[model samples]
Target: MSPGASPWVLASPDVREETAMHDHRRIGRELDLFDTDPLIGAGLPYWLPDGGAVRHALEEYIRTAERRAGYRHVYSPVLGKRELYEISGHWSHYSDDMFPPMDVGGEQVVLRPSLCPHHALIYRSRSHSYRELPLRMAELGGMYRSELSGVLGGLTRVRAIQLNDAHIFCTLDQVTDEAHAALEMIGRAYEALGIAPSRHRLSLPGPGGKYVAAPGMWERATALLTDVLDRSGLPYEAAEGEAAFYGPKIDIQVADGAGRESTLSTVQIDFHQPEQFDLHYIGADGVKHRPVMVHRSIIGSVERAVAHLIEAHGGAFPAWLAPVQVAVLPVSDAESEHAEAFARRCREQDLRAEVAEAERGSLGARIRQARLVPYQAVIGPKEAVDGEVALRLRDGRRPDPLPVGEALARIGVLVSSHSTALWDDGDGA
Candidate 1:
């Protein structure tokens, strides 16, 4: 067996079954969501169609949310010059976690470990006034870190990560409000995904000089975040030395179905990067001033979020987020054409639907397999002739038959609104 292969694969059937039920790796394989290949190197995953769909949906959801919250999305390159990191202080303190620099045309460049530095450069690309004070720049950018091989797990600890990263540039006076806004966004995102944040951590600097900001700056920034959390009536514990190399931050910890807490969202108050990049904006007095940088992410990493979602929902995704939201299963070969037509109709309504062809299994077996989908539309002769479908929900609830048009309308509403509920009873199905 491969060194990384699961030992459960060699165990008894019962043992394997019990353990594999909650294993994201096994569930990902069974659902054909993603895969890793030795030839492609460890810690790098290739998203299959199903996994790609889930990631795409998540990206769209976050982009829309950020946009509505006044965030402007931007694309930045993954690789940067060595001088860039040196100026940003990443080379001095964070180089150990970053990949080795490559010599390209006698100049050293490396993959970015985070998107904050790139966004800082973008902010400096333009001259702005205080009117643009709360400038929110967002990106769903990919990053690479030199994580240890032993620490790399399925999606949770991959070397490559696509971050839902953003930075808010504002005056020091606006720090508290921006941080509060970030927290509100985080809460909305978690509620939409049906994941509850267990606790919050006000990560502060330690006694050492590992942090880039001066002691006074660190204290001020930490105080600002603390006041924001307190005023918002949030309960959070202070964790000394848990601050990032650059600044203090608020970490939102969420628990998965397995009850393991992971930090998936964060809001960091950065006072050092602006100094490193010399980022500035003109105030109403017509003088240059440095803007405080608020680094935040609602969903820190898309890969890890999907991994958590897989376990949180036991591979049964919500209707809007599921790769294949509906499966049309025909009762027999005679109803195959109708099933295909019904699936196509669902597709026309913007639903991810597929027809489960009855080729190698009985109707009962096919229905059982189709039940894995969030919604299953069974097409028998009578239902097919009447243009109606018997809906079997993933939760084992069988709603009454409804016309195909009405069913498609209800599904559209469920998807468009991003509802976590299986299906609404108001549909009168």
Candidate 2:
């Protein structure tokens, strides 16, 4: 074993193939990704610079994905009036899930548990048109909810989180198509992240139980989703009563490092909220009709997604998502200038690259350190004196020589693709 390889890294096969949660925790702490600052309180993570980059990348990825699918991004506050929750019916259904209110002036304010109410208000801001049948609004929304300390686990479960939330207001006639689009978007997201479809599950809570609001609506919505899933040929299993209080949902679950299951994406149909909020739009007939609302999170929350990614990739991360994709080392002081120049070229190609100062340690020692962080270490040597680099990948790969310019161009293309193609493992059969 390599000197730095820990038992945790060897005994765990997922870490070598794909990161599991336990592997993620070990790697996260070692990489200084996030920390629980006891002084800062519990269930909250203070993301270090490197960890923050991972979080930001997640947000960026979701934002771009939603935008391409006709979703507009928006922002909502972390706090709202107590009445807001009541109006949205969240208080009655999920009172226990929420934090207690804060006395403000003469009224009570509660930390927002979810962004649905705020997004609903946005929908009510003006009279919508049938031509704008599907108005999709999204937010990398920060929300807070009180939780017992025992339940918090690194970034997986947090007191505060930035939910990749979106609300789609579409006519009842547009429901199936809009839902199809949303589910497609979710599949594409998981695919891009290299998450096997077998790791993806679409959960639907079966009927014959209480709280299936508006029987007709529930039936229609469930049928639509079932049809979509079947037509898409995506493998999924239904879990009865797994639907949200408002409607049935397509829950996308992925296996974490430790072989545990967790929701990574979701698409929910809401028939209750629109009626409760009296949300409507002018139809082609100039008559008012209630628009159905669809809620989705391709990657549920940045904090949780980061946790999943860390575990999924065992902190090694894919080339595109790696915090430091490439680390350049100058074998000798004479190579420092050349190494710096080459690193800049890599950066210009949109690759995350950095130069490790020779002052830090021996070139070999730094090379090993780079592997610990699991970066592809590029060493500058005599052969690199002519603007070339001795490239090495993380997994103990042999070195190769390439011109600085050509390497940068290739790296840029690879990173920009942001994903690799592999056979769809469709939910582990």
Candidate 3:
């Protein structure tokens, strides 16, 4: 195993290969992705082995994509000083959803309900130049919410959330383009995860004391986000009072197997936070000017994303993200040696593969157990002698026998490309 890798990496914890369409709660239990304990309270669930692997893969993927897109990653504490939220106006405008403040050593702190306040402080850490206008900072960090017990069914509504969050501090002129790019990033991430947006939402301010009182800022922020959606030609609904306490946002919504919808990703134009935090960048004229803070999330939260994946794909994740990508089944104990060797070869290629244990009953039973795996490589006496293997795909396509090397190559292609296609004509299935 790689350094710092989870001990669960070796086991990968096998799950049923095929799943019927069900809500994430059912699939999460059946697939060993996550579970909740009454002692730990509602809205807090712990990830199991298989679930952790999927979440880790997603975090790494988003990290890589963010780096390629010029986002500087950062780490921030889940707990923030009570004064921080007060300064950012969360205490006034959004305290209802926050946990009660804790007094430690005469200092009050609370689990952060959002990352923007902390990120705003980071932006204010030092003087920045106009050339550094669009400083994009990202984090796969934890935030907490005080969700009601009734609303906390599964990962979808959680008290502790691992958010794929970022903030881009850009000049006024850069706001529209940055928001547009952010929306596109969310779209690309959905495509890679085999996810589809149910609809796009322009979440605008409505009648509320929760929203910032600045009407001009609200109008400008709404228009900027509206321009992004309009230019993209993607149809969207303007949801009143759905905007953040600070600004208007573009919410990318996804529906579960049960037809329930939730926001999976978001891009917001925040002029409120910069002014609240007194964030500024020196302009070409050497005068200090406020920088707009653009808030965005690609895959909102790992827990919720996994929940959606469990339902959307029916637990048959894409090869790259699947808990168990390959299951090598030996015809009998006679071919178990070849099965183990093939499994080792797959592991060397960094693919998640496992050899079926002989104690799991007959070869037919083992194959049946592995039906949810994206690819099943079957080894038998004849194939062992011929140095080839039969392939069974999750989509029920069995290609002609091929050398193990060729099979591995094709599997690697699909996994690395993050393609949704199960088979290609080139594979000759």
Candidate 4:
């Protein structure tokens, strides 16, 4: 096997029969990661305990990364007045994919299909100087899509989405630098998450498509994104009619186990929204100037991102991302207290550790049950007496036993550093 590749593979056979299984859907069910019910209806799935844990880890990771990149996080409502969508151009150009509007005491409010309009309102709420340009705002916000019943399946194509959305308001001259920085952030995030984007496409508005009438605006935005892709030295293609109705964008695509490609992350440059919302900042000359809206998502949506991670890693998540990083198992009831204490210690250290129920069956059975866990700590009579742990990795490697503290420290380092290796024992760390 390739170095550090997981052995606990989830079955991802392609659809051939009516009962054929998809990778994440099958494993998610078996592991209780997520579920679907007739009551909740199709296209809307609720995450079980394990799935919620995984999503929490991913959300925390994204928030930290965004904060480090100088993005200020915000909370925005999921519903917006119909006029907001109109000003953002979603109503005129892309209303088909949006949910119907609702009348609340005479005001028509719609479930926001996107977060840009509200963010634009936030920017317009206050005046800014040129020095405050390139203001980065981010949110892990919920949005809805009016997807057809035939198209909805699993976490990938869902009606409701928790998007990792961000918009950078910057001066025109800073567009290239901002776009470059956004792509770099995406690269670092993808590397840490083990996502290999299949391709990068420059999505442009094609003929006979609804788009902003400003040809100059389209030209500038596409050229700027093209330059960003050029300087990054990444291969990309141009796809017609794939750009947002407002402007052009860079779409990072990923393929599923079935060989179907879908957009994973995106970096879009829009010059139209500033004018539509009349958003501006004061220049050094004390004159008002328009700011560019650079929209990008490190991981487009929590659902789609998790779906890809499940497929990519085959449900054997890395230590940091695993729902349960370590499973503590005792050989018999004698070591139950010791095992529970060890698990508690792990929890105190911010590590996700759980003691497997002994009565569930034999040691072999419990081990098989937690086969996807990154690390397993087995405490037998000798281990309990000596305060040591028999460390077994999910990859089927068993090393010599070590003191409880030392074993915990090793796993702590791996999880905190997001290292894919089972244990870093040297300078390789």
Per-model CA lDDT versus the true structure: 0.87, 0.75, 0.87, 0.89
Candidate 2 lDDT for residue 100: 92
Per-residue lDDT value at 9 in model 4: 46
Please report how far candidate 1 places residue 375 from its true position, in Å: 0.6
User: Which 10-residue window in model 3 sums to the lowest lDDT?
Assistant: 3-12
Error of 4 at 254 (Å): 0.5
lDDT value, candidate 1, whole model: 0.87
Lowest-lDDT window of 10 residues in candidate 4?
1-10
Best by lDDT: 4
Deviation in angstroms for 150 in model 3?
Answer: 1.2
Tens digit of lDDT per residue, candidate 1, span 88-116?
Answer: 98899889999999999999999999998
Q: By lDDT, rank the candidates, best first.
A: 4, 1, 3, 2
* Superior candidate under lDDT, 3 versus 4: 4
Give candidate 1 regions above 4 Å deviation: 1-20, 427-429
- Extract clashing residue pairs from model 1: none
What are the runs in model 3 whose C-alpha is more than 4 Å off?
A: 1-21, 427-429
lDDT of 2 by residue, 247-358 (tens): 7888776666545566778888888889888999999898999999989888888887877777666677766677887888878787887878777877776667788888
